[model samples]
Target: MLAGKRILLIIAAGIAAYKSLDLIRRLRERGVSVTPVLTRAAEEFVTPLSVSALAGEEAHRDLFDLTKEAEMGHIQLSRVADLVVVAPATADLMAKMAGGQADDLASTLLMATDTPVLIAPAMNVRMWEHPATQRNLATLQGDGVAVVGPNSGDMACGEHGPGRMAEPLEIVAAIEARLASGPLAGRRIVVTSGPTHEPIDPVRYIANRSSGAQGTAIARALVALGAEVVFVTGPAEVPPPEGVTLVKVQTARQMHDAVMAALPADAGVFAAAVADWRVAKEATSKMKKTAGGLPVLEFAENPDILKAVAGLEDSRPALVIGFAAETDDVIRHATEKRARKGCDWILANDVSAGTGIMGGTENAIVLISDAGAEEWPRMTKTEVASRLARRIAEALEAG
Candidate 1:
């Protein structure tokens, strides 16, 4: 996805501008063509010669450089690249972008290009958190712009919070996600992950030990295979992957709604550990101690999302895979689950105390389908996800 891809990197003015120099080197190392567009204030931190020396391409600094303009017009320049990245995207620059300002060459290219744009915001924590800046960020995100990060940490300004620019490698990952192309390029997939939290009260909830590692890995694998993934997640320990449509949910009912809204997907991966039941009547306020000696909470069965989607008469996914975490009779239980739920396949894992497959990194699974069950050796969750994603691609292609 990175090789041979051309990126127009717009270096905005900030202390983080220095990081952009390293970013160019990293992208080039990945065989990406980097074209640097340095804003006027960017020159204060880094020179065009340094950027050009590293990128092996002339850094475009002036909005009206006659020689460069004659050689490659601004419109042509903007149209040539597959993607435009704004590194060290300062608060001012982001505001201008959100406001549709095109006063300079960098801004002009951003406004002129139809190519997908990604930005790595870098600013003081206060600026990043300011209501106005947040509004601008929302506007850019709404316009389909991909954002890497303004990671929370100690800032160069000696302040703390999420204002640090993401490392160059992180930006590269974001780029790869946007440029991914493979057999599932145009396919849409829905993947549910993590343990749904059923609220007992405003401050209390019931949840499982599901770390959401496998589901997040699956989403990443699907994205790597060029599928547009709709990641419907709960309170996951791991953050969701890049380059996928992220839908955050809580209770089983919310997850069901999210999954339904994400259709019509090409495939569905039910990987969440949703609770079978929820509090029949949730407490609006915190229950006071000693008020009730013992809280007798009534429970109601949660929605069966897998069964609902799998048994769909219309708008059904071509492939529907469910996960069964069992403590005993794994194979038999999973085989029965596949039939009971009407799903195409079920990946069963032994999550008993010793197996450590529930909140652990490694997984041992049995892929159960209509034909029969196939046992698989223990492997990292990521490996399992990759293998499963490949199987999905082959299955989808076959049909």
Candidate 2:
């Protein structure tokens, strides 16, 4: 799909700038035409000559270059490409992109571009984790910028964490996904995953046994089918899939807000195992055990996110899907829940003792809809996700 496509590759200042060279070669090998751009600090690591040599084109550096500007203006340069990719997107560069700064050639092109943008962040572990950087990352993702990775590993600053840029092939795969023309192309999906935690104290909280494997697999399958997915997850044991707009939350209320904010989607998959109730009045400090005998804890019902979204009159998704984990009468309970929640479909499964399906790798699903319940054979979570994604695509297309 990348054949004869054009990419504007922006290299920012970072030790990972070196990887951008190999990335250029990989794209070229796939018959992609690359237009390389370098920030001033980027020259400190890889020279313009080397970047130009590999890209088979002149590396654009200065925004005020008279000759280059006379030939091709920055505005034109930004819109000419199929997609703009920023590799080794440093903290500073990401901040500029988020804040709409255009002092440099790279940021100018980024701000001036209307095409989709993908970024591969690489920075120090501390810098990557800093609140400001995380805010910028969230802003960029909210603005529809796709992210490949800043995979966790040892950093050049001798710190070990999530600050490493993804490998060349990984970025290529993300680019291909961004440019793919699959059945669900141009569709936007919202998927909620993991178990929401209701805080009892700063350290202690109430949660469930949800690994988020199934939801993560579902998001991956949707992305592979070329859908733009907004993945809202809690603290899951599994890492989130790439090529998604990821929103992290702690409580059911937070997840509800996040899902509401990402509204008007083509469909919504409420796969999260949300807590039904939370402590009415959480303790500010840790509860003492010896001094005050067992304290009475009051409970309050959490917001019904699935039901709320399904009942939305204005922004309700065309197709709303929910999950039911039951210990008895799976189909009947799921069907009733589907009707009560006003969702289009409900994927029900038994999580009874010894079933090992809740946190396990396999699942047996009974899909409940207006027609009837359809039982599916036991399969891997990935297979289930793929099947569900395809079904969603068909449903959307039919509608």
Candidate 3:
């Protein structure tokens, strides 16, 4: 599955560095080209010659090596690879990575690379349990770094807990799974995310707690499937995925225009909780509260973006998916919405404040479509995106 793929393996200074050698061999066996980068500390556990021998390529060491830099620039080296794998990533390396401290080749390449990075942390049980390490881990994860394992078991220090590097086979499996899960390859999918702000005044507006997590997750999942995704979002708290085409919009009208402009695509996923209504005439300035009389306000219906695209005669996407944010009778409402909007599918979610699904990491959704309404158990946004992408791919293939 890794055939013809270029994988840059960054080896950190740790006892687990020895296992990385086996990982190189396993990866090469799958026809993946390996370019190994060794940290100064990594030389303590394994030799450059051994790694080179297994990889069938010269081991990359010393960021300041004049000859190597002249031939292959560090920035170019980092950008050339499809993915970066950091095994035996020590606590020091993790801290450096999380903090953008590039004192060495590995850290420098890590900071320079635009590719997806998978870090397998290997450290002492105590070090891994340290608060600083935990904080660094959160930072890395929040920065969109993928973590494999620091599995709990007997460690090299003769201590047992969560500090072991994932086994070579396990790491290979994870990598392969990542490669295989990309089912939307070569397709262009446009997704609208977050809550639109309908201006109530200069300072006041109508908005919702849509963190944009699900939309960002959907974009990332699509990227994994090799899809070129245009993510139209509002002023979301969460960061958009790397390498995505991002369009920031504040109002429903702005989002609608962005989605329409990115048209003639394979699919469209309307995940944003766009405000249903906007002030009919927004005040040029903030409306002052009158002391004696009640202030009157008028609301106008926002454009139905999903219906607009689904009912398009010429540029309609092959698949149109809409999100139904309901507080009650979720399935019934979602089913009606799917038909009313002429969308192929509706992802229904309960967004009651108590449910915490609106701006939270976890979600419980019902997939309502012409086929049927399938209730999906609560899952992380990433997992939901993965399953949805797979289902979409299945539908496409079946047709």
- Please tell me which predicted candidate would have the highest lDDT against the true structure: 2
Ranking by lDDT: 2, 1, 3
Candidate 2, residue 168: the lDDT equals 90
Displacement of the residue 48 alpha carbon in candidate 2, Å: 5.7
Clashes of each: 1, 0, 1
Q: Candidate 2, residues 209-264: lDDT per residue as tens digits? A: 89999999999999899987878999899998876756678899989987886776
- Please, what are the lDDT tens digits per residue for candidate 1 over residues 1-399? 578999999998988999998899999998999999999999999999999999999999887989778876788779899889999899999999999999999999899899988899999989987889987876886576777776667887899876888878777876787778798876778899999999999998888779999999999999889886778899899988876656677899989987875667789999999999999999999977885588888999999999999999876899999999999999999999999999999999999998877888999999998779999999999999999999999999999
Which candidate achieves the best TM-score against the true structure?
Answer: 2
Q: What is the TM-score of each candidate against the true structure?
A: 0.64, 0.75, 0.56
Off by over 4 Å in 1: 1-4, 7-79, 83-172
On the 0 to 100 scale, the lDDT of residue 154 in model 3 is: 89
Worst 10 residues of 1 by lDDT: 141-150
- Worst 10-residue stretch by lDDT in candidate 2? 146-155
